[model samples]
Target: METKRFYQQRLDEWVEESRKQAYKGRVAEYIPGLAAAPQHALGIALWGTDGQFFQSGDTDLHFTMQSISKVFSLLLALMDSGEKSVFQKVGMEPTGDDFNSILKLELVDPGKPFNPFINAGAIVIASLIQGDGPDEKSERLLQFIRHLAHDNRLDYNEAVYESERETAHRNRSIAYYLKDNGVLEDDVEETLEVYFRQCSIVVNCKQLAHMALVLASDGVDPVTKQQVIPRRYVQIAKSFMVTCGMYNASGEFAIEVGLPAKSGVSGGILSVVPGKWGIGIIGPALNSKGNSVAGVQLLRHLSQDWDWSIF
Candidate 1:
């Protein structure tokens, strides 16, 4: 009890300190909905392997998953199409460029995406998800996410979804390129609809932490103690999160925070402390590499203070 209390006290302090760092970054403006978010808002939620929970700051603030949805979509695609089929569409290496870069696709022969975490790879993964149509595919993925978070009522933020749909010209270009390369199996528009909807799934810090707990436990639902994702898929997902989840800053994040984590343009981060803890954070201000600036700083603080580094 004393230890929990002390940890909580320090966690609160860390959030306040980290909130000030939000000014150093900017909210994503390409998506009109995201641009309207509070530039300085910050929040965090942590769920321990043993069920302890700690949250502070803007815990109730809701935001889209953005790129963080790639993690779960990759897992779902792997489950739907199996390893061989999924790998045929995307490679396992990280591209050090921006997450939306298409230069590598043209540079690399056969045109497979370097990894599923990037925009191009995620579009392919979206097609790989088994469903009758875009709506079904999106619903199936959404159900999977809700199951992970143990929240049955979770749904999309339609405004953000529509905003992304209307303004995602670059994403459309990437999808069309994949279609031209024969890398995408589904209709380009259908696949992108599913992709955009998945990215717009709204979540708060507590729900994200709960979902991360399942991943932290290696695909086991922490509350029910049931296997939601196979252990092998979880291992693959974590590997990607560590190596490429933070876009171009992944290397620096590994050295500093030393945890497997995925960050979204909505200023959300879902992180794992191996078998010990699951963490979720949101700070709309993004650094140059498109990660939540204050959220990264907060993770660095907690990881250093508690020696949470896996490496």
Candidate 2:
């Protein structure tokens, strides 16, 4: 009880510290759809293993899962196809480029993407899910996410999807190239539709915190006392989260925060505590690498103070 009370104190202090950082990061503007986000938007939330929730700031804003969804989709693919089959399509190593780069894919000589976190790799992995159709597969995937977070109301961010789709000319090019080279299965357009839709699914910090909580608990929903995802799948997901979840800054983040984290342009960060906790953060302001500016700072502070890194 003392420890729980102490954590609550720290959470309040941390939330206070974060509001001061509101203007330190710029809101993502490259995509016209996300450019207009309220610059100071911020939120922090944590779900303990005991079914207690700790949340603060703008906790209700619906933001897309963005890159964070890569972890779940990758887990689903691994569960469906097993390790060897999925890894053969995409690698398990990190690429030191931007997440959506076509440059490294070409340099790798038509080989699979460096890891499942990058857009090229995620798109390929999305193609490999054993789905009857893109929509059906997406529906199933959303249902899975809803169950994990225990939030049935979490739904697609249609405006973000349309915005991403309209601006996804680069993703289309990558998908077509992979199709021509035989890296992607199913139809290129179909795969991209699924990929974009997955990216567009939106949730608040508390929901994602619960999702991360399950992963941290090794695929069991700590609050519900149910096996939500396979342990094997969680292992694979956590491994990638440490190595490739942070885009190019992953190595540094892994060293600093020491947790498996996934960041997105939407300024949402989802992290696994690997048998401990699941932390979710959101701040619309982004650093140059497309991470939540204040969120990253907050995690780094907490990880260092609490020694939460998996390494």
Candidate 3:
């Protein structure tokens, strides 16, 4: 068989294995909505410049963007405020705290939330979206993300939005603290609304993967041939991914996988291979860190098999 045939063959095999692996993990239980997801649900999808995608299992299930939205939220802030201006509000360091933890703001010197990937930092990023209110800001973010993914139909799932709103007391606390610290500009409730809305934007693996693919290709969808975001911005985002994408386990994952990736509580993992490929894996089962369990295994297997280690 030819090389292309062999790659296709392996891709099929991995999808099957991932489905079986999904059952071994447990659905994220801490979040009310997430805990209700089918524990056995599993999906893996891939999108590349070739304009072809291979997906398997329950690939159509809609899930919250959850933490994965932080990636674009950070980029939008950087794009609107410039990197230097954005960093003045949030630090690039990784903290080992739980994603929604506000303890670090007081524990650490300079008291900046650790990296844009964390909840506290992500809230600050939301305030920099350059709009008058939550609705305008969220629409701006939605438009940017839709363009990046080359999908105009993308929109928020109101159920997930309301679900998060009702359950986001912790996130609201973080947002208010950022405001108190002078890191957030928008009203606390309004900023939390935007943050919750961003997290509620639903996407499947194909949409999510293509979103990552745009970043992988330096903010250009090769198929669309449009430069959705500046190449330099993608570089910076990927840099942060390597340094801080995986929450508290970022260092461990970095040492093992060597790729800049982001994972969400919705069992979505957006893994990027800069200039080559972007992978999206969604399996609701989560570990202690709120990362998708089977999703991690799937990406780790793919990265190793494809030799996608970026380090």
Best by lDDT: 1
Kindly report which residue pairs in candidate 1 clash with one another: none
Model 2 / residue 285 / CA error / Å: 0.7
Rank candidates by lDDT, best first: 1, 2, 3
Any idea how many clashes model 2 has?
A: 1
Write the residue-wise lDDT of candidate 2 on 1-311 in tens digits: 88778887897788668757868788877667788788787788888776667787878887889888888888888877888999888988888899888987788757478889999999998987778999988987898889888889988988888888888889998888888888986898889888988888989999999899998888887766787778888888888888888888989898888889999998999987777678888898887777887888889878888888666
Which window of ten consecutive residues has the lowest lDDT sum in model 1?
103-112
Worst window of 10 by summed lDDT in candidate 3:
48-57
Each prediction's RMSD to truth = 0.7, 1.5, 1.7
Off by over 4 Å in 3: 50-52
Cα lDDT tens digits for candidate 1, 1-311: 99989998999999999999999999999889899889889999999999899999999999999999999999999999999999988999989999999899999865789999999999999999999999999999999999998899889999999999999899999998888889986799999999999999999999999989999999999888888899999999999999999999999999999999999999999999999999999999999999998999999999999999998
Better of 1 and 3 by TM-score: 1
Q: Indicate the residue-level lDDT of 286 in model 2.
A: 83
RMSD versus native structure for model 2 = 1.5
TM-score of each: 0.99, 0.96, 0.94
